[model samples]
Target: MKSIDPTIVKKKTLIYIPKLNRRQRTIVSTVFAAMLLLAIILGGLLISNERITTNLEIRNLSPSLEHPFGTDWLGRDMFARTIKGLTLSLGVGITAAAFSVLIALALGMLAATMGKRIDALISWLIDLFLSVPHLVSLILIAFTLGGGVKGVVVGVALTHWPSLARVIRAEVMQLRSAEFVGISRQFGKASWWIATRHIFPHLIPQFFVGLVLLFPHAVLHEAAVTFLGFGLSPQQPAIGIILSESMKYLSTGMWWLAFFPGLALLIMVRSFDILGDNLHMLIDPHRGHE
Candidate 1:
Protein backbone atom coordinates (compact mmCIF):
# COMPACT_ATOMS: atom_id res chain seq x y z
CA MET A 1 0.00 0.00 0.00
CA LYS A 2 1.12 3.50 -0.85
CA SER A 3 1.81 5.78 2.12
CA ILE A 4 -0.43 8.86 2.43
CA ASP A 5 1.27 12.23 1.78
CA PRO A 6 1.84 14.35 4.94
CA THR A 7 -0.09 17.32 3.41
CA ILE A 8 -3.17 15.13 2.62
CA VAL A 9 -3.17 13.73 6.17
CA LYS A 10 -3.06 17.30 7.59
CA LYS A 11 -5.99 18.35 5.37
CA LYS A 12 -8.06 15.34 6.49
CA THR A 13 -7.41 16.30 10.13
CA LEU A 14 -8.95 19.73 9.44
CA ILE A 15 -12.37 18.34 8.45
CA TYR A 16 -15.16 19.94 10.49
CA ILE A 17 -18.39 18.78 12.04
CA PRO A 18 -21.02 21.52 12.12
CA LYS A 19 -22.00 22.75 15.57
CA LEU A 20 -25.63 22.61 16.75
CA ASN A 21 -27.71 25.80 16.52
CA ARG A 22 -29.13 27.38 19.68
CA ARG A 23 -32.55 25.80 19.18
CA GLN A 24 -31.10 22.34 18.53
CA ARG A 25 -28.87 22.47 21.58
CA THR A 26 -31.75 23.62 23.74
CA ILE A 27 -33.88 20.73 22.46
CA VAL A 28 -31.19 18.17 23.36
CA SER A 29 -30.59 19.65 26.81
CA THR A 30 -34.28 19.94 27.59
CA VAL A 31 -34.93 16.31 26.64
CA PHE A 32 -32.05 15.08 28.78
CA ALA A 33 -33.17 17.11 31.79
CA ALA A 34 -36.75 15.94 31.36
CA MET A 35 -35.68 12.29 31.19
CA LEU A 36 -33.60 12.58 34.34
CA LEU A 37 -36.43 14.27 36.21
CA LEU A 38 -38.92 11.62 35.08
CA ALA A 39 -36.60 8.81 36.13
CA ILE A 40 -36.19 10.30 39.62
CA ILE A 41 -39.94 10.86 39.96
CA LEU A 42 -40.72 7.32 38.82
CA GLY A 43 -38.13 5.80 41.15
CA GLY A 44 -39.57 7.73 44.06
CA LEU A 45 -43.08 6.60 43.21
CA LEU A 46 -42.13 2.95 42.90
CA ILE A 47 -40.23 2.65 46.19
CA SER A 48 -42.25 5.15 48.23
CA ASN A 49 -44.85 2.78 49.65
CA GLU A 50 -42.44 -0.05 50.41
CA ARG A 51 -40.06 2.21 52.32
CA ILE A 52 -42.67 3.62 54.66
CA THR A 53 -43.32 0.23 56.35
CA THR A 54 -42.32 0.42 60.02
CA ASN A 55 -40.50 -2.07 62.28
CA LEU A 56 -40.05 -1.41 65.96
CA GLU A 57 -37.10 -3.77 66.20
CA ILE A 58 -35.03 -1.62 63.87
CA ARG A 59 -36.12 1.72 65.27
CA ASN A 60 -33.56 4.53 65.87
CA LEU A 61 -30.76 2.71 64.08
CA SER A 62 -27.89 4.66 62.62
CA PRO A 63 -26.62 4.34 59.09
CA SER A 64 -25.43 0.80 58.42
CA LEU A 65 -24.85 -1.68 55.64
CA GLU A 66 -28.52 -2.62 55.76
CA HIS A 67 -29.86 0.93 55.95
CA PRO A 68 -28.16 3.76 54.13
CA PHE A 69 -30.22 6.62 55.51
CA GLY A 70 -30.60 4.97 58.91
CA THR A 71 -33.90 4.46 60.74
CA ASP A 72 -36.32 6.95 62.29
CA TRP A 73 -37.42 6.75 65.92
CA LEU A 74 -40.31 4.62 64.74
CA GLY A 75 -37.89 2.29 62.83
CA ARG A 76 -39.14 3.44 59.45
CA ASP A 77 -36.50 3.61 56.74
CA MET A 78 -35.48 7.24 56.21
CA PHE A 79 -34.56 6.65 52.57
CA ALA A 80 -37.97 5.21 51.79
CA ARG A 81 -39.76 7.94 53.65
CA THR A 82 -37.78 10.61 51.82
CA ILE A 83 -38.47 9.14 48.41
CA LYS A 84 -42.17 8.73 49.14
CA GLY A 85 -42.47 12.24 50.46
CA LEU A 86 -40.68 13.60 47.42
CA THR A 87 -43.09 11.81 45.12
CA LEU A 88 -46.05 13.23 46.99
CA SER A 89 -44.55 16.69 46.78
CA LEU A 90 -43.91 16.28 43.06
CA GLY A 91 -47.55 15.33 42.50
CA VAL A 92 -48.73 18.38 44.39
CA GLY A 93 -46.35 20.62 42.48
CA ILE A 94 -47.49 19.37 39.09
CA THR A 95 -51.19 19.68 39.91
CA ALA A 96 -50.80 23.16 41.36
CA ALA A 97 -48.70 24.33 38.43
CA ALA A 98 -51.28 23.15 35.92
CA PHE A 99 -54.09 24.92 37.70
CA SER A 100 -52.07 28.11 38.03
CA VAL A 101 -51.21 28.11 34.32
CA LEU A 102 -54.87 27.75 33.36
CA ILE A 103 -55.76 30.68 35.56
CA ALA A 104 -52.93 32.68 34.06
CA LEU A 105 -54.04 31.96 30.52
CA ALA A 106 -57.64 33.02 31.13
CA LEU A 107 -56.81 36.15 33.08
CA GLY A 108 -54.00 37.07 30.73
CA MET A 109 -56.25 36.87 27.70
CA LEU A 110 -58.98 38.87 29.38
CA ALA A 111 -56.59 41.57 30.50
CA ALA A 112 -55.10 41.90 27.05
CA THR A 113 -58.21 41.66 24.87
CA MET A 114 -60.98 43.17 26.97
CA GLY A 115 -61.97 46.82 27.55
CA LYS A 116 -59.76 49.29 29.41
CA ARG A 117 -61.74 49.02 32.68
CA ILE A 118 -61.31 45.25 32.83
CA ASP A 119 -57.63 45.55 31.90
CA ALA A 120 -56.95 48.06 34.68
CA LEU A 121 -58.75 45.89 37.24
CA ILE A 122 -56.77 42.79 36.31
CA SER A 123 -53.55 44.78 36.41
CA TRP A 124 -54.37 46.06 39.89
CA LEU A 125 -55.10 42.54 41.09
CA ILE A 126 -51.80 41.30 39.72
CA ASP A 127 -49.97 44.09 41.49
CA LEU A 128 -51.82 43.39 44.72
CA PHE A 129 -50.84 39.73 44.74
CA LEU A 130 -47.25 40.56 43.91
CA SER A 131 -46.94 43.06 46.73
CA VAL A 132 -47.64 40.55 49.52
CA PRO A 133 -45.04 38.19 50.92
CA HIS A 134 -45.46 34.87 49.12
CA LEU A 135 -45.28 32.46 52.08
CA VAL A 136 -47.63 34.49 54.25
CA SER A 137 -50.29 34.62 51.54
CA LEU A 138 -49.94 30.94 50.89
CA ILE A 139 -50.36 30.12 54.60
CA LEU A 140 -53.44 32.26 54.94
CA ILE A 141 -55.08 30.77 51.86
CA ALA A 142 -54.16 27.21 52.83
CA PHE A 143 -55.49 27.68 56.34
CA THR A 144 -58.71 29.22 55.10
CA LEU A 145 -59.27 26.28 52.75
CA GLY A 146 -58.96 23.82 55.73
CA GLY A 147 -55.26 23.00 55.49
CA GLY A 148 -54.77 19.77 53.61
CA VAL A 149 -53.88 18.77 50.06
CA LYS A 150 -56.75 20.79 48.71
CA GLY A 151 -55.74 23.82 50.69
CA VAL A 152 -52.16 23.63 49.51
CA VAL A 153 -53.21 23.17 45.90
CA VAL A 154 -55.61 26.07 45.97
CA GLY A 155 -53.16 28.32 47.75
CA VAL A 156 -50.37 27.60 45.31
CA ALA A 157 -52.64 27.93 42.32
CA LEU A 158 -53.87 31.31 43.45
CA THR A 159 -50.48 32.73 44.34
CA HIS A 160 -48.37 31.56 41.40
CA TRP A 161 -50.45 32.99 38.55
CA PRO A 162 -49.81 36.73 38.79
CA SER A 163 -46.34 36.84 37.24
CA LEU A 164 -47.16 34.44 34.42
CA ALA A 165 -50.47 36.16 33.82
CA ARG A 166 -48.70 39.48 33.43
CA VAL A 167 -46.36 37.95 30.88
CA ILE A 168 -49.27 36.47 28.93
CA ARG A 169 -51.10 39.74 29.02
CA ALA A 170 -48.15 41.54 27.46
CA GLU A 171 -47.82 38.86 24.78
CA VAL A 172 -51.52 39.05 23.92
CA MET A 173 -51.39 42.82 23.74
CA GLN A 174 -48.65 42.54 21.12
CA LEU A 175 -50.63 39.93 19.22
CA ARG A 176 -53.65 42.24 19.18
CA SER A 177 -51.84 44.67 16.93
CA ALA A 178 -50.38 42.07 14.60
CA GLU A 179 -51.37 42.17 10.92
CA PHE A 180 -53.12 38.83 11.01
CA VAL A 181 -55.26 39.80 14.01
CA GLY A 182 -56.42 42.98 12.30
CA ILE A 183 -57.23 41.09 9.07
CA SER A 184 -59.18 38.49 11.01
CA ARG A 185 -61.19 41.20 12.74
CA GLN A 186 -61.92 42.91 9.40
CA PHE A 187 -63.36 39.65 8.09
CA GLY A 188 -66.13 39.97 10.73
CA LYS A 189 -64.82 37.18 12.97
CA ALA A 190 -66.18 37.49 16.49
CA SER A 191 -63.72 38.54 19.22
CA TRP A 192 -63.77 35.11 20.83
CA TRP A 193 -63.41 33.39 17.47
CA ILE A 194 -60.46 35.57 16.52
CA ALA A 195 -58.87 35.03 19.90
CA THR A 196 -59.27 31.27 19.72
CA ARG A 197 -58.20 30.96 16.10
CA HIS A 198 -55.57 33.68 15.81
CA ILE A 199 -54.08 34.58 19.18
CA PHE A 200 -54.24 31.46 21.34
CA PRO A 201 -51.98 29.34 19.14
CA HIS A 202 -49.17 31.85 19.55
CA LEU A 203 -49.41 31.68 23.33
CA ILE A 204 -48.98 27.91 23.79
CA PRO A 205 -45.21 28.11 24.27
CA GLN A 206 -45.56 30.78 26.92
CA PHE A 207 -48.25 28.80 28.67
CA PHE A 208 -46.20 25.58 28.79
CA VAL A 209 -43.01 27.29 29.86
CA GLY A 210 -44.85 29.26 32.50
CA LEU A 211 -46.47 26.08 33.81
CA VAL A 212 -43.10 24.36 34.23
CA LEU A 213 -41.49 27.41 35.85
CA LEU A 214 -44.28 27.48 38.43
CA PHE A 215 -43.52 23.95 39.69
CA PRO A 216 -40.57 24.64 42.01
CA HIS A 217 -42.42 27.51 43.68
CA ALA A 218 -45.44 25.31 44.24
CA VAL A 219 -43.32 22.52 45.72
CA LEU A 220 -41.43 24.85 48.03
CA HIS A 221 -44.55 26.61 49.24
CA GLU A 222 -46.35 23.34 49.80
CA ALA A 223 -43.47 22.14 51.94
CA ALA A 224 -43.28 25.41 53.87
CA VAL A 225 -46.97 25.48 54.75
CA THR A 226 -46.97 21.81 55.64
CA PHE A 227 -43.90 22.25 57.83
CA LEU A 228 -45.78 25.01 59.64
CA GLY A 229 -48.79 22.71 60.22
CA PHE A 230 -50.96 24.51 57.68
CA GLY A 231 -50.73 22.26 54.64
CA LEU A 232 -50.75 18.45 54.35
CA SER A 233 -51.82 16.16 57.20
CA PRO A 234 -49.06 15.09 59.58
CA GLN A 235 -49.75 11.40 58.97
CA GLN A 236 -49.15 11.75 55.24
CA PRO A 237 -45.68 10.99 53.91
CA ALA A 238 -44.98 14.42 52.46
CA ILE A 239 -41.66 16.22 52.41
CA GLY A 240 -43.00 18.92 54.71
CA ILE A 241 -44.18 16.34 57.27
CA ILE A 242 -40.90 14.45 57.10
CA LEU A 243 -38.90 17.60 57.73
CA SER A 244 -41.25 18.68 60.47
CA GLU A 245 -40.90 15.33 62.25
CA SER A 246 -37.15 15.40 61.86
CA MET A 247 -36.96 18.63 63.86
CA LYS A 248 -37.86 16.92 67.14
CA TYR A 249 -35.27 14.17 66.67
CA LEU A 250 -32.37 16.40 65.60
CA SER A 251 -31.61 17.39 69.22
CA THR A 252 -31.37 13.65 70.05
CA GLY A 253 -28.33 13.24 67.75
CA MET A 254 -30.34 11.45 65.05
CA TRP A 255 -29.09 13.71 62.24
CA TRP A 256 -30.00 11.34 59.40
CA LEU A 257 -33.70 11.90 59.92
CA ALA A 258 -33.58 15.45 58.66
CA PHE A 259 -30.40 15.38 56.61
CA PHE A 260 -31.41 12.88 53.93
CA PRO A 261 -34.97 14.13 53.44
CA GLY A 262 -34.03 17.80 53.39
CA LEU A 263 -31.14 17.17 51.03
CA ALA A 264 -33.33 15.18 48.68
CA LEU A 265 -35.93 17.92 48.71
CA LEU A 266 -33.29 20.54 47.98
CA ILE A 267 -31.96 18.53 45.07
CA MET A 268 -35.42 18.01 43.63
CA VAL A 269 -36.27 21.69 43.96
CA ARG A 270 -33.02 22.82 42.35
CA SER A 271 -33.41 20.34 39.54
CA PHE A 272 -36.88 21.67 38.75
CA ASP A 273 -35.59 25.23 38.93
CA ILE A 274 -32.82 24.45 36.46
CA LEU A 275 -35.26 22.64 34.23
CA GLY A 276 -37.63 25.59 34.25
CA ASP A 277 -34.89 28.09 33.48
CA ASN A 278 -33.72 25.94 30.60
CA LEU A 279 -37.26 25.69 29.24
CA HIS A 280 -37.78 29.41 29.52
CA MET A 281 -34.59 30.02 27.56
CA LEU A 282 -35.71 27.48 24.97
CA ILE A 283 -39.23 28.89 24.57
CA ASP A 284 -38.51 32.59 24.73
CA PRO A 285 -37.87 34.00 21.26
CA HIS A 286 -34.99 36.22 22.38
CA ARG A 287 -33.06 33.71 24.53
CA GLY A 288 -30.92 30.51 24.28
CA HIS A 289 -28.09 31.83 22.12
CA GLU A 290 -25.60 31.11 24.86
Candidate 2:
Protein backbone atom coordinates (compact mmCIF):
# COMPACT_ATOMS: atom_id res chain seq x y z
CA MET A 1 0.00 0.00 0.00
CA LYS A 2 1.15 3.55 -0.72
CA SER A 3 2.15 5.50 2.41
CA ILE A 4 -0.12 8.38 3.46
CA ASP A 5 0.46 11.27 5.89
CA PRO A 6 -1.07 10.44 9.26
CA THR A 7 -2.21 14.10 9.73
CA ILE A 8 -3.98 14.15 6.37
CA VAL A 9 -5.76 10.84 7.09
CA LYS A 10 -7.19 11.96 10.46
CA LYS A 11 -9.70 9.88 12.38
CA LYS A 12 -13.17 11.18 13.04
CA THR A 13 -13.87 12.84 16.42
CA LEU A 14 -16.92 13.56 18.52
CA ILE A 15 -18.42 17.04 18.64
CA TYR A 16 -16.61 19.65 20.72
CA ILE A 17 -17.46 23.02 22.14
CA PRO A 18 -15.09 25.60 23.51
CA LYS A 19 -14.98 26.12 27.25
CA LEU A 20 -16.66 29.25 28.59
CA ASN A 21 -14.70 32.15 30.02
CA ARG A 22 -15.41 33.20 33.59
CA ARG A 23 -17.84 35.98 32.68
CA GLN A 24 -19.69 33.85 30.16
CA ARG A 25 -19.97 30.95 32.58
CA THR A 26 -21.20 33.20 35.37
CA ILE A 27 -23.84 34.85 33.22
CA VAL A 28 -25.14 31.53 32.01
CA SER A 29 -25.31 30.04 35.48
CA THR A 30 -26.80 33.15 37.12
CA VAL A 31 -29.49 33.54 34.47
CA PHE A 32 -30.46 29.88 34.55
CA ALA A 33 -30.53 29.71 38.35
CA ALA A 34 -32.41 32.97 38.76
CA MET A 35 -35.05 32.06 36.19
CA LEU A 36 -35.50 28.57 37.61
CA LEU A 37 -35.92 29.91 41.13
CA LEU A 38 -38.25 32.71 40.11
CA ALA A 39 -40.44 30.46 37.99
CA ILE A 40 -40.75 27.86 40.74
CA ILE A 41 -41.54 30.38 43.45
CA LEU A 42 -44.06 32.26 41.35
CA GLY A 43 -45.65 29.15 39.91
CA GLY A 44 -45.92 27.57 43.32
CA LEU A 45 -47.37 30.68 44.98
CA LEU A 46 -49.81 31.37 42.14
CA ILE A 47 -51.40 27.96 42.52
CA SER A 48 -54.37 28.21 44.87
CA ASN A 49 -54.64 26.14 48.01
CA GLU A 50 -57.73 24.62 46.39
CA ARG A 51 -55.50 22.40 44.29
CA ILE A 52 -54.30 20.68 47.45
CA THR A 53 -57.68 20.56 49.17
CA THR A 54 -59.08 17.21 50.27
CA ASN A 55 -61.09 15.04 47.83
CA LEU A 56 -61.76 11.65 49.40
CA GLU A 57 -63.00 10.38 46.03
CA ILE A 58 -59.41 10.47 44.72
CA ARG A 59 -57.68 9.32 47.89
CA ASN A 60 -54.38 7.41 47.77
CA LEU A 61 -53.93 7.59 44.03
CA SER A 62 -50.53 6.80 42.52
CA PRO A 63 -48.58 8.96 40.09
CA SER A 64 -50.43 9.52 36.79
CA LEU A 65 -50.87 12.07 34.05
CA GLU A 66 -53.70 13.67 36.06
CA HIS A 67 -51.81 13.70 39.39
CA PRO A 68 -48.15 14.03 38.46
CA PHE A 69 -46.91 13.50 42.00
CA GLY A 70 -49.83 11.29 42.95
CA THR A 71 -52.42 11.95 45.70
CA ASP A 72 -51.84 11.77 49.40
CA TRP A 73 -53.90 9.50 51.63
CA LEU A 74 -56.20 12.48 52.29
CA GLY A 75 -56.75 12.66 48.50
CA ARG A 76 -54.86 15.97 48.24
CA ASP A 77 -52.75 16.45 45.11
CA MET A 78 -49.13 15.89 46.17
CA PHE A 79 -47.82 18.10 43.38
CA ALA A 80 -49.86 21.07 44.56
CA ARG A 81 -49.05 20.37 48.17
CA THR A 82 -45.34 20.18 47.40
CA ILE A 83 -45.44 23.43 45.45
CA LYS A 84 -47.35 25.22 48.19
CA GLY A 85 -44.99 23.91 50.82
CA LEU A 86 -42.02 24.95 48.69
CA THR A 87 -43.40 28.47 48.39
CA LEU A 88 -43.70 28.69 52.15
CA SER A 89 -40.18 27.38 52.51
CA LEU A 90 -38.95 30.00 50.05
CA GLY A 91 -40.61 32.74 52.05
CA VAL A 92 -39.05 31.52 55.24
CA GLY A 93 -35.64 31.28 53.61
CA ILE A 94 -35.76 34.77 52.09
CA THR A 95 -36.95 36.43 55.30
CA ALA A 96 -34.55 34.61 57.56
CA ALA A 97 -31.52 35.03 55.31
CA ALA A 98 -32.13 38.75 54.87
CA PHE A 99 -32.26 39.31 58.61
CA SER A 100 -29.24 37.11 59.13
CA VAL A 101 -27.17 38.98 56.53
CA LEU A 102 -28.14 42.33 58.02
CA ILE A 103 -27.19 41.17 61.49
CA ALA A 104 -23.89 39.92 60.16
CA LEU A 105 -23.15 43.17 58.35
CA ALA A 106 -23.90 45.34 61.37
CA LEU A 107 -21.98 43.25 63.84
CA GLY A 108 -19.07 42.74 61.47
CA MET A 109 -18.65 46.45 60.80
CA LEU A 110 -18.90 47.26 64.47
CA ALA A 111 -16.38 44.61 65.44
CA ALA A 112 -13.86 45.84 62.92
CA THR A 113 -14.39 49.61 63.17
CA MET A 114 -15.18 50.03 66.85
CA GLY A 115 -12.57 49.90 69.63
CA LYS A 116 -10.91 46.79 71.02
CA ARG A 117 -13.44 46.33 73.82
CA ILE A 118 -16.34 46.16 71.39
CA ASP A 119 -14.34 43.92 69.10
CA ALA A 120 -13.55 41.57 71.98
CA LEU A 121 -17.20 41.36 73.01
CA ILE A 122 -18.40 40.71 69.48
CA SER A 123 -15.65 38.18 68.91
CA TRP A 124 -16.58 36.39 72.10
CA LEU A 125 -20.20 36.23 71.07
CA ILE A 126 -19.19 34.87 67.70
CA ASP A 127 -17.06 32.22 69.34
CA LEU A 128 -19.83 31.29 71.75
CA PHE A 129 -22.31 30.79 68.95
CA LEU A 130 -19.79 28.90 66.88
CA SER A 131 -19.00 26.52 69.73
CA VAL A 132 -22.55 25.26 69.97
CA PRO A 133 -24.07 22.90 67.44
CA HIS A 134 -26.22 24.90 65.00
CA LEU A 135 -29.17 22.54 65.09
CA VAL A 136 -29.15 22.44 68.86
CA SER A 137 -29.28 26.21 69.16
CA LEU A 138 -31.85 26.43 66.38
CA ILE A 139 -34.09 23.89 68.06
CA LEU A 140 -33.79 25.60 71.44
CA ILE A 141 -34.45 29.04 70.04
CA ALA A 142 -37.38 27.84 67.93
CA PHE A 143 -38.87 26.01 70.91
CA THR A 144 -38.39 29.05 73.15
CA LEU A 145 -40.26 31.17 70.61
CA GLY A 146 -43.18 28.67 70.76
CA GLY A 147 -42.66 26.77 67.52
CA GLY A 148 -44.51 28.39 64.66
CA VAL A 149 -43.63 30.34 61.54
CA LYS A 150 -42.39 33.26 63.62
CA GLY A 151 -40.32 30.99 65.84
CA VAL A 152 -38.79 29.15 62.92
CA VAL A 153 -37.86 32.26 60.95
CA VAL A 154 -36.46 34.02 63.99
CA GLY A 155 -34.49 30.98 65.08
CA VAL A 156 -32.91 30.58 61.65
CA ALA A 157 -32.03 34.26 61.42
CA LEU A 158 -30.43 34.32 64.85
CA THR A 159 -28.50 31.09 64.44
CA HIS A 160 -27.11 31.58 60.94
CA TRP A 161 -25.23 34.90 61.39
CA PRO A 162 -22.13 34.09 63.39
CA SER A 163 -20.09 32.45 60.63
CA LEU A 164 -20.99 35.11 58.12
CA ALA A 165 -20.32 37.80 60.69
CA ARG A 166 -16.85 36.48 61.22
CA VAL A 167 -16.19 36.59 57.50
CA ILE A 168 -17.47 40.13 57.21
CA ARG A 169 -15.53 41.23 60.24
CA ALA A 170 -12.31 39.98 58.76
CA GLU A 171 -13.08 41.61 55.46
CA VAL A 172 -13.80 44.92 57.16
CA MET A 173 -10.66 44.67 59.24
CA GLN A 174 -8.60 44.28 56.09
CA LEU A 175 -10.50 47.08 54.39
CA ARG A 176 -9.96 49.41 57.31
CA SER A 177 -6.18 49.28 56.84
CA ALA A 178 -6.39 49.96 53.12
CA GLU A 179 -4.57 53.08 51.83
CA PHE A 180 -7.71 54.92 50.75
CA VAL A 181 -9.40 54.45 54.13
CA GLY A 182 -6.26 55.61 55.96
CA ILE A 183 -6.05 58.66 53.67
CA SER A 184 -9.73 59.39 54.27
CA ARG A 185 -9.14 59.22 58.01
CA GLN A 186 -6.16 61.54 57.68
CA PHE A 187 -8.32 63.96 55.69
CA GLY A 188 -10.64 64.33 58.73
CA LYS A 189 -13.38 62.05 57.36
CA ALA A 190 -15.59 60.52 60.02
CA SER A 191 -15.93 56.77 60.35
CA TRP A 192 -19.50 56.88 59.09
CA TRP A 193 -18.52 59.03 56.14
CA ILE A 194 -15.65 56.75 55.16
CA ALA A 195 -17.76 53.67 55.62
CA THR A 196 -20.59 54.94 53.48
CA ARG A 197 -18.34 56.49 50.86
CA HIS A 198 -15.86 53.64 50.61
CA ILE A 199 -16.16 50.59 52.82
CA PHE A 200 -19.90 50.08 52.52
CA PRO A 201 -19.81 50.08 48.75
CA HIS A 202 -17.21 47.34 48.77
CA LEU A 203 -19.14 45.28 51.26
CA ILE A 204 -22.36 45.32 49.24
CA PRO A 205 -21.24 42.48 46.97
CA GLN A 206 -20.20 40.40 49.98
CA PHE A 207 -23.49 41.07 51.71
CA PHE A 208 -25.51 40.00 48.68
CA VAL A 209 -23.46 36.86 48.02
CA GLY A 210 -23.66 35.99 51.71
CA LEU A 211 -27.41 36.48 51.67
CA VAL A 212 -27.82 34.14 48.70
CA LEU A 213 -25.55 31.55 50.31
CA LEU A 214 -27.56 31.65 53.50
CA PHE A 215 -30.80 30.65 51.79
CA PRO A 216 -30.01 26.97 51.50
CA HIS A 217 -29.11 26.73 55.16
CA ALA A 218 -32.18 28.63 56.25
CA VAL A 219 -34.51 26.54 54.12
CA LEU A 220 -32.99 23.24 55.21
CA HIS A 221 -33.07 24.18 58.90
CA GLU A 222 -36.66 25.34 58.70
CA ALA A 223 -37.64 22.06 57.11
CA ALA A 224 -35.68 20.07 59.69
CA VAL A 225 -37.14 21.76 62.76
CA THR A 226 -40.63 21.61 61.29
CA PHE A 227 -40.20 17.94 60.53
CA LEU A 228 -39.25 17.42 64.16
CA GLY A 229 -42.41 19.25 65.20
CA PHE A 230 -40.49 22.19 66.61
CA GLY A 231 -41.36 24.54 63.77
CA LEU A 232 -44.46 25.07 61.65
CA SER A 233 -47.80 23.52 62.59
CA PRO A 234 -48.93 20.26 61.04
CA GLN A 235 -51.94 21.92 59.47
CA GLN A 236 -49.75 24.24 57.45
CA PRO A 237 -48.55 23.11 54.04
CA ALA A 238 -44.93 23.18 55.18
CA ILE A 239 -42.39 20.89 53.54
CA GLY A 240 -41.59 19.48 56.96
CA ILE A 241 -45.22 18.68 57.59
CA ILE A 242 -45.53 17.03 54.21
CA LEU A 243 -42.46 14.87 54.84
CA SER A 244 -43.49 14.07 58.40
CA GLU A 245 -46.94 12.89 57.34
CA SER A 246 -45.47 10.95 54.44
CA MET A 247 -43.39 8.88 56.83
CA LYS A 248 -46.54 7.25 58.20
CA TYR A 249 -47.50 6.04 54.73
CA LEU A 250 -44.11 5.05 53.30
CA SER A 251 -44.41 1.63 54.91
CA THR A 252 -47.69 1.12 53.11
CA GLY A 253 -45.91 1.49 49.74
CA MET A 254 -46.81 5.16 49.37
CA TRP A 255 -43.32 6.00 48.12
CA TRP A 256 -44.40 8.87 45.88
CA LEU A 257 -45.73 10.82 48.85
CA ALA A 258 -42.26 11.31 50.31
CA PHE A 259 -40.08 10.89 47.26
CA PHE A 260 -41.46 13.76 45.19
CA PRO A 261 -41.57 16.32 47.99
CA GLY A 262 -38.13 15.39 49.26
CA LEU A 263 -36.75 15.61 45.74
CA ALA A 264 -38.32 19.02 45.22
CA LEU A 265 -36.86 20.33 48.44
CA LEU A 266 -33.45 19.03 47.47
CA ILE A 267 -33.68 20.66 44.07
CA MET A 268 -34.72 23.95 45.62
CA VAL A 269 -31.84 23.98 48.05
CA ARG A 270 -29.35 22.95 45.40
CA SER A 271 -30.56 25.72 43.13
CA PHE A 272 -29.93 28.36 45.75
CA ASP A 273 -26.49 26.93 46.34
CA ILE A 274 -25.78 27.12 42.63
CA LEU A 275 -27.03 30.69 42.43
CA GLY A 276 -24.87 31.70 45.34
CA ASP A 277 -21.78 30.13 43.87
CA ASN A 278 -22.38 31.79 40.55
CA LEU A 279 -22.97 35.16 42.18
CA HIS A 280 -19.82 34.82 44.22
CA MET A 281 -17.82 34.08 41.10
CA LEU A 282 -19.29 37.08 39.38
CA ILE A 283 -18.52 39.32 42.33
CA ASP A 284 -14.99 37.96 42.83
CA PRO A 285 -13.58 37.00 39.48
CA HIS A 286 -10.43 35.54 41.01
CA ARG A 287 -12.46 32.73 42.55
CA GLY A 288 -13.68 31.66 39.14
CA HIS A 289 -10.12 30.94 38.01
CA GLU A 290 -9.83 28.34 40.73
Best by lDDT: 2
Best by TM-score: 2
* Model 2 CA lDDT for position 140: 99
lDDT of 1: 0.89
Write down the TM-score of every candidate: 0.88, 0.92
lDDT of each residue in 51-128, candidate 1, tens digit only: 678789899999887888899988898888887788889999999999999999999999988889999999999999
Error of 2 at 224 (Å): 0.3
Off by over 4 Å in 1: 1-29, 288-290
List candidate 2 segments past 4 Å from native: 1-18, 288-290
Query: In candidate 2, how many Å is residue 62 off?
Result: 0.8
Candidate 2 yields a Cα-based lDDT of 0.92
